[model samples]
Target chain A: MTSNAAGAGTISYEQAGVNYDLIDPLKVAAQRAAAATAGHLAGHGFTEVKASRGESAYVVDVGPFYLASIVECLGSKALVADEMGKLTGRSYYAGIAQDTIAMAVNDLITVGATPLVVQAYWAAGGSDWFGDAQRAQALVEGWKKACDTCGVAWGGGETPALAGIVEGGRIDLAASCTGIIQPKERLSVGDRLGAGDAIVLLASSGIHANGLSLARKLVERLPQGYMTPLADGSLYGEALLAPTVLYSPVTEALERAGVRPHYCANVTGHGWRKLLRHPAQLTYRIDALPRVPEVLRFIQQHAQQDDREAYSTLNMGAGFALFVDAADGQKCVDVARGLGIEAVVAGRVEAGPKQLLIEPLGIRFGDDDLQLR
Target chain B: MTSNAAGAGTISYEQAGVNYDLIDPLKVAAQRAAAATAGHLAGHGFTEVKASRGESAYVVDVGPFYLASIVECLGSKALVADEMGKLTGRSYYAGIAQDTIAMAVNDLITVGATPLVVQAYWAAGGSDWFGDAQRAQALVEGWKKACDTCGVAWGGGETPALAGIVEGGRIDLAASCTGIIQPKERLSVGDRLGAGDAIVLLASSGIHANGLSLARKLVERLPQGYMTPLADGSLYGEALLAPTVLYSPVTEALERAGVRPHYCANVTGHGWRKLLRHPAQLTYRIDALPRVPEVLRFIQQHAQQDDREAYSTLNMGAGFALFVDAADGQKCVDVARGLGIEAVVAGRVEAGPKQLLIEPLGIRFGDDDLQLR
Candidate 1:
């Protein structure tokens, strides 16, 4: 933070390092403590700018148009081996980039935002040179491929090396996307919604990406056939991995059908509860609900968890949810089903203060301070 | 972190809570642990997107540009303050963004590129609401101003909340930046530099965001005046917080004059040693270097360090370096000095392995042995 040949507007990075102009010797000493790392600086080949910094500040123009959003995922399933036993498992970190890309693009579909560049980060415990390099190159390639799948281009991304900060062989993949919408076509929270609006449920591929930490914990403590039963009754890690479902086709169908949803969201973490964040005072009545899959039942029964907790955490077999007028609802569902998803009319919208009532499941969510707060 | 009935994506902020996904059965316990701190998520209206995503990806529209490189001051400047009895200090957290953005952009400038956005993040610590929010806002505002000054735009950024993973009141700012450049207009690192090339030093502030952990330890044990003196005669904190000199104007002139350099780099940690990262195998000989500032002299005298060690670990007044042809060497120096920065016909380019040898400073640095193994 010390400046030489200083004048006004001559700021530097030291101030940003948390070192003030206070006269304390020990503070300087403390800041220098981590300089003894084992790895050497990346060899000066052709001016290797750090990948992390490059991703943050560098903007590229591959084509025209105010591009679209960037979608990404952390490939939590990769952590199965990372958090559990590393030896008795396979080493495939490449799928994470694809999953991360899928997660980002899926969100893009909701906003009608086309994606452009997809980026990610990969962290490892001990740098397995061959393995790590393969994973890095493969991850970038997969992300690019996924962006292409969404009919977009993958600009660039980052792969930083944080040696000591992250220890247990963990590489977290998170993404930030940017997209645009025609001002008139943009969706807002308070779009008009009447009483006769219908709810459409898109079938889920088991548990999806959320609630795995709890599911694994509960399954690990349950009986052999408790979570994922096999022929003779065994566990199912694949069931838990349930590759993320993308609704790009649904986007196409809805657009072609000229259907405009009053409200929409990707049923990800906490499933139906995510809808509440729209911040409107409306009651959702589920007179007819989608069938719950076996995986969720196993998790609930084995963990002895209540229905509220389960609904607030797992997908409950519905990958996505949409609320449209009753007149257009059947058509939307038909179009979704035509696109291969098990879409069906499930519920309706009513007047209330942000409440969700399920008479059949005997579940009354949203009003309980225990849940909302 | 969640999705809803309508296909348009929306989610409640609470759904994105780290533990909302059953990552911890003892979520209540975990939430309780995360509670009782400042730095809480501040609710604010998200900025409206002003451009398209595709073209928006690269904000740069034309040919010539510049760059800055950034890396978090991983050293314990914060710990040094904690040891000094000021645990609640806003600390140097905000300053990290400056370096992070600089680190990214400086590289772009080395090859001649213009920055687009300055994005950064911090791993959340004790939920210090006021402290965290103020710092967060300050960081964004600072970055926005920096980009604005440089004729670049500031795209939105990320801020992750990690409670238990980090230490008490400590946050790690992960910075990334994106920039742009034209293929033809980019400054190729292969310009002619005969035996009389100029190696100009764009003076540095003390430890401008690097090698702080070791610095604090050594400075703490020194007698006095061993660091920058603060507004109130405090000798410790001010020097470390001194900001780095930005090399924006000097490089801009080079581009304007169409003076492509044989090599260039932001003088950060490892000082002249990092110059070898440049392409073109030649001996970069520096002469008539500027006087080492008091900050470095203090560290040298107090730590009983040699000039080589001092420059190796500290910028010693030079924040950015360049290698221009002997033909344009004087012009380069004249242009730099005209811009109020002291420059010298400091070096030459001779046939040899790509390397940097500052004979006057008695130092040698290169990117030869530290290959990615």
Candidate 2:
């Protein structure tokens, strides 16, 4: 299981060919351009909630309600699933579907909106790719299961076969969801995220759909490939492919229990660095951290990535974070526990520069690491 | 312009490498699978308006409002623009962005929902594709223009760089939109379609966003590549790259004029055959077909496609259709005209088997041709 050398040299996410430096500028430009069209919402008797523009989802002010919409792709993780399927002959589409839905719904719930409908966009290089009944059935069943888990309807979608634009036999899975936050008070745009608020870290299942490009690159160096077993005797690929945790249930439970989180962040591409994603300038002091998942540890060791690179690029076991009043911190944790989610008050918000501090690892991430806003 | 021999051989869309026969069944299966999750809407205090599924968009019943959502891809049409850009040194991404938005908003209005927000999903095979500042800026500017034209807010979207799943330097563009049908009476799910309903056909800018795979295949055989001149003295690629007509304005005008369409269909993939997309058993008899745009004529002649194959695959000049009361047909056309859309009363609905008959072309499409339901 440990045949491959852990580290001969240093490696980074950008070294594996995925660079946030090039992508972030385009995102910022796109946000500015999209802001120009927000005035159109008034034509339909709705108002544009400008605060939600750069957030995970776009929130619109409809009469008596606010609607949140988000469009997200599962990224190159589907390709990893395809590769793993070829090696083991086991259908990995179910997990891919779950990851795709999770990417969208998790972002939707960041604003405290309950997802209503999820529409899919499955663009394949060829139509024959779906001929594999087992894979196709797994994808459909998994999508339904994810939608059911999030309490959202599986709306109709488009399955386009782009022969030349997409690589043959590969499917690019993405989904867009529409959610609602009724009574308006449930809307959590981080406006109330104040100092002394508790930061509860929700446990992630595994990789959870981010940093797959780097993970796939790491597999090329693995002598055993997907068959490589972790310390727990589980296949590396299987562990990484574990379906992402659906945090919608936890958010719903928190709302039901009257524990309103001032802000929520889905720990994804930016890893634990997402802890300081709130627009306000506040230091996130993390005194504790969740146990690192085995799959992520394997990735860290194989890729020779240091703690900074690993925590900035991968989820590192923490899937989500919730900021709530100090008095309601334990209540939020209890609500998540009631929903079978392992969570704890891992940190707290403090008046300072926007930065994250990991007390155990002695690591810190400045606001510059998360350029989402 | 007339150098290529016309009708030298019988050409079908399937021969060009796209077969709806195999694609339709999967669509049917997907629709069935998605239906199972509709019950989840109840958790959000909304209901799945069952009638909206399988239509151009999925409509959900929210309190005091019905929301219509659709996720559509631009298909390989952007590749056409990419090819054209390589040849002409012109940035065609502006038109490509418009086409992507048109594909979503056109379907959105089919159910009488005024688009409130449109979110984009741009999956590129490489991150450096956006480094071409000219091309990227054109895309941003054009996307904003389309949103402005449709009077919808441009909600932010995901720009994923999928290194392996998509072709390098190429992007697969798609978008999802959420719309509102207020006063509920404006909802048009074909329930009002009757024998005497008149069908109005709106003029297409060119090929729109469908049949690009076949079109790209035809380009391989072009004698002059993108520089080939058509009878009208316009380059073939430039003609095909014409921005899709934004029909949201027309729908808005019609609704403002109190002319609610019995049903509406975006003339895209499956071409004019989309006229019979309604689940009801009725014959759409076209007494007057819109003049085939020069671009379609060029493609049909060069590809050796007959009227049947041409109209069944490409838009062939008809971009959108509105089924309305016989007396209100002229009013609808006038409304479209006021919005600068060339429209005419082209047909009428008759009680019979679900099919479309183009009287002038002597072409008929049976129910089997469109298996959307």
Candidate 3:
């Protein structure tokens, strides 16, 4: 097993060549442009939920239901899977497919929508990429299994063999899901979120799809690369490639238990900073934090990132967070536990400046760290 | 203008690295897996339209409305736009954006669904790809304009900068669309077509999305490359970058005119051979063919392909095909003309072996040419 005492220089997501400063501005500009085109939806008898513009999912108002749609891609994790496959003589594509579906469905549930259908966008460098029957069959079976897990149909998708744009021997996996929010009361875009809402955290299986660019970078510095064993005696790449937890069941069960969260956030991309995802000007002070997975701990130690940097860039141990009435936090946690997901009441919302504080770790993230809009 | 007499070695789609023989079987396998998952849709209170499995779009029976969804990507055309931008000092991203949206929406209408919302999937090699403000703004503006043209909302999308998977200096564009098929009778999946149905051909702008790999290869053989001027005085790359036609309005107008086609085929991927996209075995005999676009004509002359290969691989001139009752053929043409789209009754379906006979070009395509299922 790799030792934590071997110090490596500090690294950030930007050093891994993923600079949010350069990427977020274009996203904000696109959101502004997209807002102007909402009127076109009215012609089809469906209206855009204007508040859902910068949310994790885009919601539309149909007469009887609110439809939420999201597009998400499993970023660069497949590269890690490819490398690990070459080393282990086992295909990780099944889990890779789960990661792709989970990336989309998890975000769709954040808007309080139940996923109905998922369409895939599998673009490869060349047609020969599919010539590997083992990898292809594993991908197909995994996609079907993921759809079965999420209760969404595996709708058709595009498989374009893009030779020049995508790198050879690599495939870019993405999925778009359309979900429905019935009764219109289930739409959670943070409008009902108040200062006293309790935050319930759901445990993650491991590092999900986000921040993989940096994770892949860390592998290059390790002597054993993907084969490096973690503190738990699992290969570094195997732990990283653990299939993402399907959180839709938790939300679905919560709704069935007669508990509606004031707000929900899929802790992805920006990591713990996602607790402040809502536009409401409130403080999120966390008195407790979930146990960081061994893999994430290993990454933090090898990367030499401080507590604040690690929490803000990786999921740590929390895969999802739900804000509900102060009294309903335990019930939300119980419902998640019933679904076999580890859960805890990690924090509460308060009336203050827009920021998040981790009391245990003595970490603070100002609002500027995440400028999605 | 460069003359067509200058001959180059013959090129095929396979030589350009897109081989359907290697790609289509996986699609077939995926469809089989997808079919088994249709039972999952029952939990969402929506049933899958089994007949739509192999069609251009996937349809779901959502009680009051049949929902159709499709995922499509602009293959290597954006690469062409990138090279042309370097040579001509102009941003072709606006048209490239249209090509992406058109590629999806055109296919959506083939199943008689009217598009409601379109979400984008823009994957770049790095965050710096959006550093070019002129190109980014053109892409944004073009997306909004195309949505307005198709009367669909511009829903939120994902723009992930994939560092290692995608090639630097290039971007891959894809989109997924959710459309509504109201009244149920408007859904056309080729169940109504038998024989004596008139085939109406709609004009294409130029090489729209498909066959771009082969077209891009032709540019390499040209001394002027993308700058080579055709007989029409338009540069080769400029003509190839012409935006795809939005056929949604044509289909919507046909519905309003009370003339639902027995079937419709988006002339993409499989080219004119898409006329047999229906699972039913029928002979499509054409007495007339539309004029080949100048860019396509130049491609045929340079690549030295016979009529059968060109028509089966490229759209040539006809971008879309509609098979309707003989009596309503002129009405469909009139409706398209009202919208300024050139249309003609080019052929009729006959009771014979599954094949397409082009009398004007003496070209024949058997069922083996296209096995989308």
Candidate 4:
């Protein structure tokens, strides 16, 4: 099956995504807009070009002194939570909080920042979470417990009641995490990654949180318990709902060992667009990956999606990727192992123009998002 | 007219009046949520609670040291702008800058802060507003012009784009304004006004930017070209859209006139909630007030709302309320006249709990919001 045909086949919001043509012009517009006001637009180190008219988004120069990160993911997992509620499942919101923190904490680690405060916003149609104070308090406490486990402070969040916007008692949970970084540098694929650097794969706890929107659509069509082809087949729901693992400690150990990873990118969705945003003249070749769980295989086959599509559509087994010096690679892996997470030699960078070459599998993500633009 | 309706009788998010029971518990829950995180909250000093959990919409505060205050408002006006587009009118987002700035600036004046920056987020469905680039640029420009007129600085903002949850095609505009305030000794309705303190009234510019969700609904029921109707059949959309006058210079004058003026509050609605919040025990009696403008009269009639409901719903013609010594009452009038806005003595304090007593008009508002328990 063609990649686009399997994923993003149906036109949706990105079809309504910001007009890329207006991207450059809006930068120019924002410059003019900022000039007519008080302080000059704060300069952010990440911005490559500052333009003139309208804008897509304003990236605040939060200044590197200390960085606070706020991130949350949206997926059909909330729908699963609804199902669990009907079937009398217990973990409920606690299960969702694990994934929320998993996503937020990972963002902080990727940015070399540690989590500070986590504030969540839960929007549901007409759920009286307040009436059952125990349930409401428990939901928040569960989120706090997850944060405490990750060694981060827990803040608070808003539980908004939107009468019509939400559906089926379905709720969307989001978190804003504040992070701090006495950051020595920023991480992107473009620079540090040179040819021959070793790549390391960090084991993911189940899915490690992402692609719920894609996963939900696939699971809907699959016959229940298709993986075992037996009893009550809610395995897809349980697997897809598995909480993501927090990896702050894993990345922290690598940093403490003075093993600077040449390039690190959170690997999710077997697709290559995000990785492609890295260095323009280096090739990222990943040879080894942790065991692929059968849950993904069952869902992928049932959805009629191919291997390449499933990879980019799910995190597979590896949630994070790291590139290190070939000479110090074992030390880095040892440090990662010390943190209680499996770290294995994945592959090496090669001389090429920003490409991901999957050798053993004879697969190449080369067309739209794979090649360097 | 019920005493607690948040908007005019115009159709609103709640076709029937607000469900205070639902709203009340939400506020208590919000307070719990806010307080849990507030101890860890940094950056600003919490100001007066504007509309509390059981009472109103926002709880506004003033910033210290940074001296800048942020004014945040629910952009109900954006709904009207959207409806304008849905109907024959397209440039409906017009004149919203004043409302954006007005909502914030009004809050700033309460704490003796002068606005410096006005940033807005407009979520335009498929497009970019609730705040994308183009609207941010324009809103900033509009705020700049309005703030420049009031001698306040126009700083920048943060705009975003969201695809789901919010209505797809409508743009939702919300603002966060930052203004500079010097050390003003605790300005909470302090223990100053006791018996016989005169209440003075200042005029509101049109709707003064709140409750447009209902106003738009009422406006839609009218025929085309009805938006700009004026005496002699002249179109006056510009008049209705006029920005609320920035009262920074006048507030500064009132402070300098040795007129610690007991207490003061900006009047967005006819109800004097802020005045009641001041630390004083007196019955505020209104003796004389300027003629109510026709636009308010229309909203009052069109929505089929009477005096008290309409009073708390729309600002009517009075936008600012100040309590002063009867001795300097005329001087207060002279100052507002100097600022080119008409003002007069509306009422006075008496020997009792804070009550809004309309003497000439023969009405008494036993407002629960004025006294913070």
Rank order by TM-score, top first? 2, 3, 4, 1
Native contacts kept, each candidate: 0.00, 0.78, 0.79, 0.09
Task: Name the runs in model 3 displaced over 4 angstroms.
Answer: A1-7, B1-8
Model 4 bad stretches (over 4 Å): A1-39, A42-80, A83-210, A225-234, A243-272, A278-281, A290-295, A318-352, A358-373, B1-17, B37-77, B89-209, B216-295, B316-367, B370-373
Return the TM-score for each candidate structure.
Answer: 0.60, 0.97, 0.96, 0.64
Over B178-244, each residue of candidate 4 has an lDDT whose tens digit, in order, gives 3333444424233565687777887766666654545655654556534557553533343445566
Tens-digit per-residue lDDT, A125-144, candidate 2: 88787777888888888888
- Weakest 10 consecutive residues, lDDT, candidate 4 chain B? B51-60
Candidate rank order under DockQ: 3, 2, 4, 1
Instruction: List per-model TM-scores for chain B.
Output: 0.69, 0.95, 0.96, 0.78
Over the stretch B1-373, how does candidate 3's per-residue lDDT look in tens digits? 1223234567887777687777777788888888889998888778998989989899998787788887889899999999989988899999999999998999999888989888989999989988888898898989988998999888889888987788998998998888888878989998888799999999998998899888888877889988999998999999999999888999989988999988999999878889989978899999988888999999999888888889989999999999999999999999999998898999999999999999888888999988788
Cα lDDT tens digits for candidate 4, A215-310: 555544444521333123545666666667667777666666776666566654333334444534677787776666556665556555566666
Give i-RMS (Å) per prediction: 16.7, 1.2, 0.9, 7.2
Note the DockQ of each predicted structure: 0.04, 0.76, 0.78, 0.14
Residue B323, candidate 2: how far off, in angstroms?
Answer: 0.9
Candidate 2 lDDT over B171-265, as tens digits, reads 99999999989879989998998899999999998999887766777776777877899999999899989999999999888888889998999
- Model 1, span A182-224: residue lDDT tens: 2224332235555678878888766766665555555445444
C-alpha local distance difference test of each model = 0.49, 0.87, 0.89, 0.53
- For model 2, what is the error of residue A172's alpha carbon versus the real structure, in angstroms, after optimal superposition? 0.6
Error of 2 at B247 (Å): 0.2
- What CAPRI grade goes to candidate 4? incorrect
For model 2 chain B, give the 10-residue run with minimal summed lDDT: B1-10
Model 3: pairs clashing at backbone N, Cα or C within 3 Å: none
